[model samples]
Target: MPYCPPDCSCNLDGTVDCGGVDLKEFPRNLSESILHLSLQNNALEVIPMEELSRLQNLETFNLQNNRLTSKGLPDDAFCSLENLLYLYLANNKLTVAPKYLPKTLVSADVAANYLTKIYPLTFGQKPNLRSIYLHNNKLTDAGLPDHMFNGSDGVGILIMSSNFLKYVPKNLPKELFRLHLKDNKLEKIPKGAFDHLSKLRELYLHNNYITNDGIDNETFWKLSSLEYLDLSSNNLTQIPRGLPRNIVLLHLEKNAIKSIPGSWLTQIKNLEYLLLHNNKIKAKAIHPLAFKGLKKLHTFHLYNNMLERIPSGLPRRVKTLMLLHNQITEISRNDFAYSYFLIELNLSYNKLTSPKIHPEAFRKMRLLESLDFSGNNLNVVPSGLPKNLHVLRLKENEINSIPDGSLSGMTKLKELFLSNNKLKLNSIYPGAWKQLTNLQLLDLSGNQLSYVPTDLPESLEYIYLQNNQISVISENAFESTPNIKGIFLRDNRLTTSRVKEIAFEKLKFLQVLDMGAYSESATESKKDGGTSGDNLENDSEQATQNDK
Candidate 1:
């Protein structure tokens, strides 16, 4: 009796659920005690194989995403499923690598497919073959043949990422442990290419064209149970002299790496996230004890490079320090004297200038929280920072003034960028932002201001003040913020009769009022739709008359 094909599903333990059923073929009534068969995502282009060779007690044969090819799989088609153990032909259109695989396969997903050749005894010595997903396929290196993973000694995870392999893939499989050759045209790494794997552990080889004399100083000296090593972007100019001290996250960013040898940070002293950003690093070729013995390092990116300072013996439990852009002109006060659990400090752009900061610079960080110092050439606002700051960017720079207590001990400042710079609404001072009071976003766009800056801080909610020359909108200018909601003041020199149309009627939860070049008198005061609260008529005057 053969009766379940209305988009199949015959169970009772002898499983046979036809998955994603648009079944173009193969589902023709078969229940000879099915053991487990899921024809996955089926527009089954042709896998009839004499009706699946009479399912000899199949044991999990999921034909994954099926437009099955290789001329419809014939010669000894899965050789009568000798009680197969998981063989999902992934993505499908397979070119070759499926010569009836079934030495009771223990996991074989012919990944993504179009497998440009793989012949030499394609899985012939399969003794319970363990995990082999031939990643994204057009695999090169002459279609892999020299002892094609010799007699699979229980191969363990070999995902050949994005192929065309220019090297390293010979006879691998001494029980390999995760070898994903990321983005391939792999340029030379043959010295015992992980000789006898020693149960390898996560080695990605990021982006590939691998250089620096194509790797040989004892390859990786037999991977001592490696732990995550990405070798980012590749063309490697240095730093690859047998790295394998049980590495714990070391992605060498972008490349051209100019010198790092402090005997390579004394061989990764259990490195904890050390990503050398962008590259060309040239601060007198490093080595002031080049990050002295990592000591459980915690995130240090060294962004952009050519560093003109700040690289002295880091790793006092570093907590995120991305020296953005570089040429760092001065930050001394024992420049981060032993990290002290620093928290997020990105010296934006760099050639910093506010008299090179030395008033006890950041005074032992105190668990600092987000301090960027955008662009550079700073003119002020650099007082001994770190009062548990919560984001303080200082955009562009040449800052002219904000004087009065320049942010009296931060008080957990909440995002303050001070846009473009050389500011001048009478150079700020009258309680300059009144001790921030947990200020909520205040950019002060571009610069050369004409007004708007008196004791602001009732926890203001977003105020950018676009471009500048602001021709007054005073009169209770937001009367100490009723939680103002976004007021940008686009382009500037405002008009609608120089602003007092109830100057935003005490904001009332205003929602975005941009007012670019006075938006045609705020669109004729919203076409004269008169209403109370001093008549500028709601929604922040239709958001400054639909801010165009």
Candidate 2:
């Protein structure tokens, strides 16, 4: 009789959780002040007696996914669990291993189950087991369990993912700090599964099929406090030399890693974040001492990666440079002349036609701000931006108009991601952004606007004029402009509208007024209605969302 689910609740320490409920057995009379008990997923298949050691204040008994297999449970069950730590008998059909658990256990997540074998005193009855989730089950690698991380803080997070690991277990346990041997059947990585992690840190060896000859240099001279290194997917083609310079973040996307290893960017040099997308590197495999000592690199993701070019001794103190798609057609300005602390430049999709932007191509950027040349084949819009460039992502390309002053030398231009190009309808060109007076986010959604051009820009906040071809708003259409906080004119088509005198009253900081995804009209030309959605719903944003 184990059916206690009146929406389950019991605080003061006892944690009873009938997780996922679809029960098939063991749900009999709980409430002995449960101290952590989640019958995850449910449909119990036994191990029910000891009635949870007669509620001696239980302490974590999550029969993960239910339907048990092996028994030998009630030797006084958890014998009045003396603060039982955490025992989660993983997914069902257990082939054996469930012997008298509870030895002041610290953590045990018998991953997936179906015990193919595990009898080395099965955790010697939990000698304070410190984090162990036998990933996916069917353990191999020569039937691990010689003393699989003999506890005492030794097993500090070990999830043998997917299992049947081909290697990676040269007796690992120098107090491992977190090691999920991802999707196994490994091709290698043994040689001292990190010879006693020198205080390892976040290492999710992704979908392994392994390569890079299973890595060298004594497998990273003992992870020197590794910081988050997910060797993405895998079958790595190269670049796995001696990597462990206090890695800050290195997710070698997809892998078949063709390049990028000037000795691992000079031994990781506190690398800031380098996600090598796709990969099959070329362009002279970038070698000017490729990122010689990544002086705190700040985000450099090589998008799509087939690279026609863009990699050249890179390290102009990068600050976000994601080269989209690739096969870059060409756009030399000394390729960021001296990068001078480059700033946000994502050359979208690529194969560009003639993106000639050399008016000294940003003269040695003086902290050049956001600049993304959407998709490519840009027909126009390029006037040496960097006069304090703000944000300018020329979406999709083949730009039709809006290039007269071509953004009058961006005097601190705000945000302007010109939505999908070939802009039609009024073709927006009121002096090509009437010298953006500190304009604000203005993504013209997916262009082709029909009407409503009242010259918006008083430090506008956000105005993505939804899809195209409007109906009306032109009572002078935002006559005395400048005060907009947000006004995305929803999905255009419009009907009921007015807005005559003092249109939007100098927008005293109008906050977010998305006209119904685009004129479903019905703010009735809002006069007393829209001060633009309560100007930032105050109260300090409800005390910063209650301190999160």
Candidate 3:
């Protein structure tokens, strides 16, 4: 049996855990055969080199979330652990990386520290070292040498985000597969900075001050294996040239890009996700054939732009297209003629009106499952909505009525939000939602309703009628919605005597009846010879517990 410390737990498999014991110092008398030791989440400030060297067979050491500083760790602190494979020293006060690391180490995490510099040989010649995480540190370009990882030929992943580097580090390992330099002060990328990194697949350079002139034309042309590239939140006025041909996901949102010429994206055949929202892109500035060759593209986001109409030549196989918060006033019939595979469409917060939207605008979208047209100028729901839509949002509009047979084809609708409109009791057609057998949630709050609308779907589970003019709940108000679980009638004019007891007696599954602000309002209505004040208070309390 291995000896276990008084404040730690020891196992037969050479593992010791001493985490979160408020330990002020390192434990003593650890087994020499220990393979893993965890001292995280403690107050340990110093590591006894001689005592730690006794565990020659240790392979993993974790000192994360401790108070270890540079003075507590000597240059040769971990030199004797020849078999150490992983080391974690995150969340410390070290200003510099420790020197003379073991050659057998495979991974090192010194992130979330005060590290401002790293010696050239701090990592030594560890041939097996693969990953180095130094994020959330105070590292600067002057503290880093040109040949940072020259000895570690197998280093594949290096993360140095949130640093003060003014430019891309030079002489990185050619075998690097992923490099993260985001959230830095980088201003430019030299011509041959990444020419040797052919195996690089993911590069994150977002949240920097890089401009269009700061990048060379041939900077990223040689990265043939690159797949994911993020250049968002930059100062580029146009799309960069010479991107990798096989790139998959491209993020250029929150930039100053104004236009995309036809040749900018004609070479990227394997692109899947293209995010260009929050830019200054206009519809006419984009070439007609800008997205013609992207056959595998699925998601395209162009919201928060200056587009006045749908861009032509969208990806044929694109499934999600987000064009909200634009200046588009009309939707022509041929706008989406080739985008038949779209599953989700969001054109909300635009200048669209009822007559400007062609009646056959959405006729080709048979596979669309979600549609949002809220925050527009439409006075009524847009017709020609696909039958397979599962969610529909038309709130914050001027809609006042639901014409008969308008929504009779949406039998698969599950959630319908028509709140914040001008709807009234007599404006809605009777049995408008009778064909919606799969409906589950209906939102009609912030309207001009005088009474509960009859002919609600039987499959409804939740209803929102708050902030309306509702004053009565007839006995048959909820007769068709026996499966209802929650009814929100707060901020309405409902009184105790007007809300029949039988209206809530049949709702056995009702769990929430929000009638807040009703007591104060009902008291005023009762003073006008409505009902007895004592009876109104008693019935209101009983309605809240009907489910019990």
Candidate 4:
């Protein structure tokens, strides 16, 4: 029967909750036997030290989202709670690390504060401390004492990102498993900065100013357990030498790197994801055997570069290859000769035309699933696409016709996007989509169609035919497709008199039928009290909500 505060709730398990009550001061008459207390999301400006010291059995303290300042927190605010294991003082106005923290602290989150410095003995002698989150602070390199974490042998994760540190902090705990210093001003890594952190697994240093000359050759060679490293958005002109051989994921995008040496990554056999987009990498600068030994690499992103053709030696086991937004004009037969496991390939926004693309360019990718050839200059659909493809995007091209037998083998195709092309109703061959039994969506919007194309797949669920010159939808236009759910024929020349009610009679699952903005003359006919035009529009609207 312990006394609970008037505005708070108390549990029999020694937990008290008083968060988000617009509390301006700490609640009184709190049970001394309480083990957990929450006072977050309040305007608590000061912590009454003498009053809080009575709760010696308290193990977790949360004062996050308060107005606690450095001067208000006394030197012995949290030192008296001998059993304090978790402390959360984040989103406060503290200008320095709280001093005299109990040695029993396991995790402390002081993130999103105005902390500018950490005293020498702030986290020095805590052997049980494992995590310290001080990100989004204003701490500089000089503010972090060299021996800040001197005696803390068990500190594992330290997040100091979005700071103003100019150099890597020295004498870090040897048992660190993850360190995040991204969004900092780090310019150099002193020779032995990370030599002692043998158990470090992930290091994030992106959005910094680290150049190749500033990184010592042996800086990251001693981290045997390192697996993920991000050096994106930096000033490096080339790939830094002496990266850990066992790393799995490497991110080097948004750098000024121009060339990748042949032997740079030959030893990292465990690499899986490599991102090098938004750089100045040219096709000739990539050595013939640059990516020869990466067997486990599945995702490679080299888009937004100055490459005229596909690089010679891509990873053989890559499953997703993104080479869009480049100067690539053609795909030779041998470009993807060894990529047998590729599933998704995007070659959009390149200078590729139909004649420049070799017929056998994509012949070896039998397992391909999604192919995007959009934003190109092709007069017809490219041949030799994989039959197992499920999604194909040929939008924003000059494609005027689909040659017969071009898509007859792709039985598993599901979605086709041919919007914003020069396609007309007569340009599509008869039964062009006859073999596509699994097709679900067809997008032919922004085309030059005067009539709806016939012989659509029966499995179609959605069709987009907006932004065309279609003046009439034949009575049996959708007779072949019965499972269609949505039809977007907006912004066309469809009038009320031309639309027959029987055209949409068989679509039982239809939900949306938007025939946008009729002419003023059509609306005048409805105003003249004609039931023919009004009934036809009303019946089509009623069909959209059938069987729901």
Candidate 5:
């Protein structure tokens, strides 16, 4: 009995759920073993094809969103669904591309629509057509068709991103494996445009105004199973020289790459994740054996760029080396003397100074673990850093001092950022941070401190002596830490009688005691000394008993 079709729902196996039921047509009598026919979100301008040619086993035909145009579709209007296998006309107002379809169709989603020209055997010799979503629409490049992708079609996922293609769309189909031409107005890629694609593997030409004179130094040299290549932003001023040497993720961030010609990492020796940050790279235009054969290069992003130094033969199996900012002023004992697999080293800002570093500059980083050397023009703290350091960002530099065994071989130090810098309070020498035993977050904020610089590390949990010149706190100060938890002392020079009543009672995991404006003049001097307020009522009852 399944002949439903009118604002439909007849599902006893015959399947005919007319989606968004306001269907403005094409829903008569319906059931001829109609194998799924959902006229999605309807106002179907046309495509009745004689009420879908009496549905002879129509294998899934969903007219998505709909306002169907292209003069309401007539030529071969799906040649009567001859066992059609999935054809979703996405969005709709189709300006073409809805012809005969059925070469045993296996997925053809005419995405968005108003498709500006694409009529040459519309997906020729469809070898079981494998996924084709013509993204967005207004396709250009003369509306596409230079053999429209041959090799007898077995199209393996081809999403023509955005559109208005300026080049690179000629006879693509080498059974393409994920080729999304992003944005689009592709300013050129015509060098045998991937002749014989070799099962191309993920190639998204980012942004697109591709330069280097429209690319062709053997254009990716026949993509030998290329692996993930996103030419970021575009207008590249180089670095696109026969890429695919089994490329493993190579995204040229931003672009306009100034120089790095060591045969581009000896022709991508299995390169592993190399994103050239920002770009316009400099440091004498890079070539000191340009990263001597990457050897599985691990995360190397040259932040910002115009590098003035530190590009001295990098890749000692680099493990995250992002040169932040640039103009790096010296660290010279052979720069990073054959890196030794460095583990995170970001020379923040740059122009680093303390006698231009060389005291065995980081004596071959014994697996460094996070070091930023913030802002730079450093006053100290750079003998040979890497004691397996765990995050040591010398903030805004000009570091006034902290010398005696400066952070003595960091014993796995955990987060220590000498803030703003130009430090004081005897510039910290007494047992400096007693070898940080895993110190947890300590930023002597905005420096020039007057106190609180004692041998902190009892695995302290978050301490940023905000602003500085801290008035006083000597009741055994933080009584040699009790896992102090967040004590910022905001905008320092604290008052409440120079803070003493068991100054934060051994910080029982004290939570956020930021007294920035010193508790508003100690609660207005507690209404001008109410209970004979000596020592500002014992520093406001020891900061309300160490914040309960």
Candidate 6:
């Protein structure tokens, strides 16, 4: 009953059911009443503007993902829809826009197209136009006169991500709320580029050619409502001076940031969710009280950084902490003596000999539900863990053995991750994982295990055992784990036949059988179905090393 894609003007105004269909041209049955029409992912060579001219009541139009290289719309094609609001024409092989359209149009999204440049005085008369998405285009302000976007006040969103913008355009509108210019070729953002966006809130300029030397005085003095600012994926080796005090989320990941400049964020009290991951910041150089007054901070991620050890004391009010992919050797005493309401901790991808835990280290943490200690060299886990630990990720480690009662204090443990650990012994302590009745996911990739132990929880849903030296998987290896959704046994020396087929039939909820470390083709297997799997983390790793 409900099937229409976005960027189409329907009377009901719902953007759905419009993707990758084999339509020759625009739909004629709904042409008149359609407010938004999208002929995307179709074999239509001609856009058939005459069909659109008949639609007087249409308000929105989307012609993306089509073979319309010739962006020639009749001058009066949209003269009927005087009350039109939004328009999207992305991925249409467009080079230059028609420069003629309705006057009442508000939001225009032309991203992922071939828009090379904009003509002077083009779209300057559209007073009500706001929220222009021009990302993934070849736009450049090099030849145009400065002072672009000078008077567009009613604008709200300007997504110019992945363009050739060398510097911030001059004379920006003050009413802008969200401006995304990430993955561009911007070398610098002149002080005047942000001079007028006083009411701006979210500015995304990540993956640019910018550095801290480009930041000038009054860097962020106007934007008081600025909350989510992403300066990550840049060439910034230092934090800019004089940021707005009201910023809540600052993403500085994947940069050449070596040390945070003092007095840069000295007095921001409302700041929360500071992501300094994938940088080259040393552990000792980071100030413990740098987040001193941010009591409301709930999430602080510093994974994939250049820290050799955990910072001794951080802000006491942190809830979620991520410290993966660092060079951490061991957890010293009083390493985390500050967190009072700590909920989640991730210490994966390090060189720890063992997951050493100190007494009362997590005693004050009450709501912790997740912990990722994967990709480390831990031989064993220390005693005295928190009681309510739900998820324990210790994958890709060098664990040889775990003594009896190693997880005794962890009574309410739900998931115990021991993937990629060295298990040489055949007999595990009775009831070693008995307390973990609610265990779910267990990944044992890249290990020297000969056989899977029979002590896993029954509530396990997902299991990964690829890239191991396992030669046999007994029928009782997963005897009681009926809720298992997926099991991986590929790329191993499985001497037994009928394992993959047998495991799938036994596990009622079997969905996937990831084997051999997920071949490179399986990268884009996600819910969104987009083939561009996140290469951001890898890029961030290289950026961190480059900055250091």
- Evaluated against the true structure, the overall lDDT of model 6 is 0.67
TM-score of each: 0.37, 0.36, 0.94, 0.95, 0.34, 0.75
Runs of candidate 5 exceeding 4 Å displacement:
1-170, 173-178, 181-202, 205-261, 264-380, 383-401, 404-548
RMSD of each: 16.1, 15.8, 3.9, 4.0, 16.7, 9.6
Worst 10 residues of 6 by lDDT: 539-548
Which order, best to worst by lDDT? Answer: 4, 3, 1, 5, 2, 6
Off by over 4 Å in 2: 1-62, 65-120, 123-146, 149-157, 160-170, 173-178, 181-241, 244-312, 315-358, 362-382, 385-403, 407-415, 418-548
Candidate 3 per-residue lDDT over residues 1-548, each given as its tens digit: 88887778888889999988899988887889999999999998999997899999999999999999999999889989999999999998898999778889899999999998887777647889999999999999998877778689798999999999889988888788999999999899987999999999999999999999999778899998999999999888888999999899999999999999998997999999999999999999989889887898999999999999998888889999999999999899989888899999999999999888887878889999989999999888777778889999888899998877779879999989888899987777778877888988888888899988888999998888767888888999999999998787765787766878788888999887765543445666534432233331233443322122
Which of the predicted structures, 4 or 5, would earn the higher TM-score when compared with the native?
A: 4
lDDT of 3 at 413: 93
After superposition, which runs of candidate 3 have C-alpha atoms over 4 Å from their true positions? 519-548
Put down candidate 1 lDDT per residue, 109-223, tens digits, no spaces.
Answer: 8889889878655675787888888889888988778877566788788898997788987868787788899899998888786867878888898998999788877788688
Relative to the true structure, candidate 6 reaches a TM of 0.75
Q: Candidate 5, residues 1-548: lDDT per residue as tens digits?
A: 86675557877777778899797877776667879888899898987677777776888889889898988888678877778878899899888785457777777899889798876666776678788889888888887768764434688888988977888788877788888998888988887878788898888999889998988778887889888899999989879777778888889989788888877657778888889989899888888897676699888898888888888888878889999888888878888888888889898998879888787878878888888878888887776677788888888888888777867868897888878888896866787775787888878777788888777778878777766667777788777778887676655565666777587876777766655344336455334432332221223332322112
lDDT tens digits, residue span 528-548, model 4: 432232232233442222111
Task: List per-prediction Cα lDDT, in the order shown.
Answer: 0.79, 0.69, 0.87, 0.87, 0.78, 0.67
Model 3 CA lDDT for position 265: 91
Clashes of 2: 12
State candidate 1's TM-score: 0.37
Q: Which pairs, if any, clash in model 5?
A: none
- Evaluation by lDDT, superior candidate among 1 and 3: 3
Any residue pairs clashing in model 4, and if so which? none
- Which of the numbered candidates is closest to the native, going by highest TM-score? 4
